[model samples]
Target: MTVPAPAADGLPTRVRIHEVGARDGLQNEKATVPTEVKAEFVRRLADAGLTTIEATSFVHPKWVPQLADAEALFPQVADLPVDLPVLVPNERGLDRALALGARRVAVFASATESFAKANLNRTVDEALAMFDPVVTRAKADGVQVRGYLSMCFGDPWEGPVPLPQVVRVCRALLDMGCDELSLGDTIGVATPGHVQALLTALNEAGVPTPALGVHFHDTYGQALANTLAALRHGVTTVDASAGGLGGCPYAKSATGNLATEDLVWMLRGLGIDTGVDLGRLVATSAWMADHLGRPSPSRTVRALSHKEQ
Candidate 1:
């Protein structure tokens, strides 16, 4: 598929893509992926020229046994060229990540109350409150924090989330000194119009858009389109997973995130430099999918591999 091109005004023709396959991608798998494979996944991602990769989550073993080896995995690839970030749900998670010498950590919150309670077991306010100490401690230790706000679009239980709620949560995270805020389409219910509306609202509310990133799932196959909408509004950062490895554990019907290979293909075609090699990235995705005993969800990877054959 031919990707679109950006404008020619020399307006900084590069974008930042955060690879989340390690944490969000593998967290929901039924089969357990060994620690060695996870380490190789991070190594291959860095080799693909990805500078930022979410390596694992520091959640409790009972919560996500897939990443229970966070300590083991962090040390295995701690010296990689890319920035390996781990998700820290609370202060305890933060402590675990810090103990492993994690340089960057991500905290998550939802815009709707139902998702907050179901996913994080807290209300929006409560979730933010819980992160206060975590963020405070991480900053004190010189650890960078990236805040994630899920269900930025519509929700399954509650369709069509209020724009004001999204703005409120994003502003709160920014106020809390989050280095960046990633707007997530958790259930993949967002459209380009919704992306524009929310971004505009945040921009009008004096929230810094530059520090904002977009995370879209392809449940409805609109992830790339929504990404375009974000780019048009000057959102330079995007979150994607190799081979589309992640699915929301809370939402049964949700699919994996936008495929990193596909996103890179589109960006390269659009004259936007992502610093990622599409061929190597597809190979990496195929390897991981084979290891997990499942076909990849990345359309670009399948097509590219078939064409090469």
Candidate 2:
């Protein structure tokens, strides 16, 4: 595939793509992946020039059996030169990640009450309360903590999540010592306008654009559009999965995340630097798709790999 000519449209010169294939991408798989495969996936993503790769969650095995080997998996990829951030669901999860020498960790929170209850069995406030110490202790240990706020756009149980409701949870996370926040369109119901509006509201609510990341789902085929809106608003960090590999296991309506290959294609066309080699990224996703026994859902992956064949 030919690279799109550089076009500067007043966007950030460089965008950080948080690769989530190893963790969020494979978390919901019904079939268990070997620990070695998961480790190799992380290695390949880093090799593709992704700096920050979410490795694995420290959540309990019973809840997510696919990542039961977190202890075994984390150690194998701990020596990589990239930023390997793991998900820590609570204080105990934080302890688990810290024990394995994880320097960066993330906590998942919900912007709406229904998703809070469905995912964590806690109220909105109760869930934030759960993460208070997780963020506190992680910061105390000098670890970088990223707060993930899901259902920022729409919820399955609740139709449209209010802008203020999402802003409140984001504020709570930052106030609790989270180094940054990732706004998640859990059900993928966000549009470019909604994304811009929310970012503006958060800015007004004292959330800096630099401290924010956007995670969009492609359920409505709006992930890239929503992402462009964020970029125009100065959001430099974006969360995406290789080969479109993730969905909310808790939210049935949620679909695969924004494909990293697709996002890179867009950024490259726009003259935004992401340090990613598109050829290598597509190959990695194709390799992963082969391992999963399915064709990659990423359009760029399909298009480029098909021409190679």
Best by lDDT: 2
Return model 1's CA RMSD, one decimal. 1.6
Candidate 2: misplaced stretches above 4 Å?
A: none
Per-residue lDDT for 206-289 in model 1, tens only? 887899999999999999999988898888999999998888999877988999998888888778888888878899999998
Range of the 10 consecutive residues with the lowest summed lDDT in candidate 2: 1-10
Q: What are the Cα lDDT values of the candidates?
A: 0.90, 0.94
Q: Please provide, for model 2 over 53-91, each residue's C-alpha lDDT reduced to its tens digit, 9 standing for 90 to 100.
A: 999999999999999999999999999999999999998
Instruction: Show where candidate 1 strays beyond 4 Å.
Output: 1-12
Q: For this target, which candidate reaches the highest TM-score against the unseen true structure?
A: 2
